[model samples]
Target chain A: MKEIVVVSGKGGAGKSTITAGLSYFLKENDILVDADVDAPNLKILLEPELIREEDFYSGKQFKIEQDFCIMCGRCYQECSFEAIEIVNLNYVIDDVACEGCGLCQFLCPVNAISVSDKLTGKKYVSKTKYGFNMVHALLNPSEENSGKLVAEIKKIAKNLAKEQNSSTIIVDGPPGIGCSTISAISGSDILLLVAESTISGLHDMERLIELTKNFKVKRKGFINKFGLNHSIDEKLVNLFESKEIEIVGYLTYSQNIPQYLKKRVNLPEHIDGYKKLFEGLYNRLMEAVG
Target chain B: MNISIVSGKGGAGKTTFTILFAKYLVSKGKKVLINDLDVEEPNVNLFLNKKLDYDEVYIYIPEHIKENCISCKECAEKCLFNALVVAKDFWLVLPELCHSCKLCEYVCKYSAIKGSKRVIGKIGQSFDKMLHLLEGRLNIGESLTTALIKQVIGKSLKIKDNYDVIIMDSPPGTSCPVIQASKDADKIIVVAEDTPFGFSDFVVLSDMLKEIGKDYYLVINKYIDGEGYSEFASKNNVKVLGKIPYDINLAKNYSFGDVEDIDTIDFDNIYNTLLEG
Candidate 1:
């Protein structure tokens, strides 16, 4: 079995676009994983039919009960996050800022604090329109612990792949070199970085490459929207080569992307050069992973 | 007042629109401070082309004193983040996993843990006396995005008196870091697009803004002909701010130094409208 995670350090660098295209092209008993919990958009492209949805509990949130409060303000003073604030003569914890350290709960003089399991996110298993199983997640907006959610969804995808007796899982990763990106690509066999040919793209790509350098995974680079600037494109190619990452494919700029985006269509499969681009990438990826 | 430019999706031109407003405010004889809270990869200085002086943001990760340790694993057992891996002889601290909550240091019975600061990111400051840009760039392989963002906010707040307006460019996704940046803003301008993914995510984003009690305006970036962005904004009960047209020439030339013609986006009224209210 092989798992290939597509990541781009910068968002909107065509990570999901490329992953959806590649997954649709290789719709042969492969399990698709959408690990962008904060903004999971793969289902929009694939129109996945939900099979099951489950609540995900990652951490506990501490809340102060106003009824039992004496309002000593000790928690407000001791909190590092400043999550506790005086509200209507009672201290309240801002869930967004609260680090869930439990220090405030321990310090409350009247013991007005209570801890409860936080519903951090939700996990879903579904069947894509392409007849392949898909595992995805959606983190509650303004929630933390996305890395944990990504790891959980990846595990579910792996388990589903095992049950379906599939050998390949195409994981759509999120942006930023943060916990979610790390979790998505950590154990994957092949890491395909889909990057654009722009200065911001190049700079962030270098950081993403640096982040994944310690992991023992075969790395591949695909410069999506390449050929925009010859110099920038060339620089990206050199950066990829210097990292010893195989240059699997180069997708030139295509107007079909935004036009199809207007038509609410993802996976620019019918564009002039997309078929060749994705075919070359898929072939190179399989060979490299094998 | 501080305004945060945020987006549900990436490449919605959040930075582009922010620069337009900041530059426009400066042209109007108003002082502006721009804080790039997109710490994972802060590139505001790239477009401004300014030589910035940077200060490192320190995050305290525990430094274990192995000699003072009893292998009781109390520190490891009490860690909420599981950052401490208690080996057969010593405890290993995975700096990436550490949330810097000071819980491990608090629980160490043998005084085995010491507080230490590591550079997780850098805040770059640049200005031309009228417009100041604070670029918060997270160090490579670091996931302490919210910590750096808070630091950037802190640094920018100290200089808030110098500027007539403070504009923050927030990171993508409706996550904790976004909330951290959004909570401090007087107004949040959500730069979105005219696609299903973009519109749906904007809806989700507005729900978050409501939960955080923030008033937001929608600016559909890359506005094209026959897109239902205005309709979507109205349906969602969001105020339409302004739209930056889709121009390939502008995108091609975006790599060059400073932006010159931000008025083409027709954002002259937003400054007064958002400020006066």
Candidate 2:
């Protein structure tokens, strides 16, 4: 199956809006994956009903056996992460600060610390009203390993596609060119870059484009809120053309986006202009994948 | 003493704050080192107008040697990221999927797995009399930035003793890179705005700081007239270090790399408050 990931370099670029609209245009059996584990909002627009939920564990959680503990401070000194501390003549492990690197457990003279798995987040497989499977997740606040959660979401999406004989997998990737974005684009067939027209937007887009080029993925651009700065929009178009990247569509600035957010509805329903633009962009993506 | 200017959300004026802080320190005749850990979009150089000297760094991933034919599939089976796929005759390593943990090399029974380095990106540095700038750039397709950021921070460590204070402009979000940049900071100033998104992310960042035992203060940028941001500050029990009102000329000056001319408004109070604390 062909997979397409839509991502923006920074947040507030109307990525979820475009992804929601694209979901409406995709085939009935295609799988949609929301890979933005930090702030997964595509499900809000799609309104997927949770069919299955599972906990995602990435690393170990350290627990101290207080009975065997001596306040030698060896674990505290050996821990590079500063997870161990001496409190009231007893050593304690702060689970949140602990990366579970196992340095303390190995170096502990008393062997008071033991590592165990802890649930970091929950992954959900849901059924959307659009007749497609949607896989998304929520990482606990301050929890690490968003990249690993993103990979797990993709795996579920791929498996769901195979089980249902789906033809496409649509991924709404996280913003930023970090580990989460990397995991989103690593194995994708095409990358759809949704960029804005602000100065920082342009700067971040250039960096993201550089990152996408490294992965050697076929890329296209969608300029969201192009009217914010026409000059920057034109400059971006020129840059994309010079790089041989296609501009799929330019979406004009409109309050319809924020309006849809308040009403918790899809873009195509609230804005006629966006409806047409999304249809065009969806068709172009299909053709590109074809 | 490396200090990073960070916030939990984007558009919190982190770059603006960094530029202003650098200028403030420069005006005080103190040598400062500014490293833009925001490799995804390094804009400090745009405001500084200084040329950068770059050095490339590579993240090594182990490639299995085919000659040592042990198709045990141990590497693939033991892999948590599923980056290695072992076929009946051979194994394939997806470099992009690899997290560079080097666990596969350890799991190989036949010693066939060996690591090879691929240059993912470069860390660039520039120097002015007032400030030294180090910026990291990830290769266009490279997925791993934590490694590159580590390199940038590692290089910045060498000159920490040279300057009285090292200021870092960190990337947005509370991810690994952000954590890495803020790991060794003596103090963190979270630049936040008076918006709901900004408030939410500030809370998340505050939780992280509290957990990590890092002392932090909040600077509300673009403080409007009668906005009651002070009340928010009071409720959170975080001191409002200083406020820069909404000024178009100040923003324009910053965008054009002329921040040094914008009068240092309220920075003395902010710095004093930090120093006193």
- Candidates in order, TM-scores: namely 0.95, 0.76
Q: Backbone clash tally for model 2?
A: 5
Chain A TM-score vs. truth, each candidate: 0.96, 0.96
- Fnat of candidate 1 is 0.52
lDDT of each: 0.83, 0.77
Residue-by-residue lDDT tens digits, candidate 2, B32-122: 9998888766778877778888888887678878888479898887665678999878789887777665667766778889988778789
Top of the candidates by DockQ: 1
Model 1, residue A232: distance off in Å is: 1.3
Q: Model 1's lDDT to the true fold?
A: 0.83
The residue-by-residue lDDT of candidate 2 on A1-290, one tens digit each, is 99999988866566777888888877878999988776566766777898999989887787889888776777777564566777786788876556565556655688887778878889999999887889998777567678889999999898889888998899998877877888898899998998876666677788888778877679999887677666777878987898789999887765444444545678776667767978888889989989
Clashing pairs in 2: A210-B140, A211-B140, A211-B141, A214-B141, A215-B141
Model 1 segments beyond 4 Å from truth? Answer: A266-273, B65-70, B87-89, B108-112, B226-228, B255-258
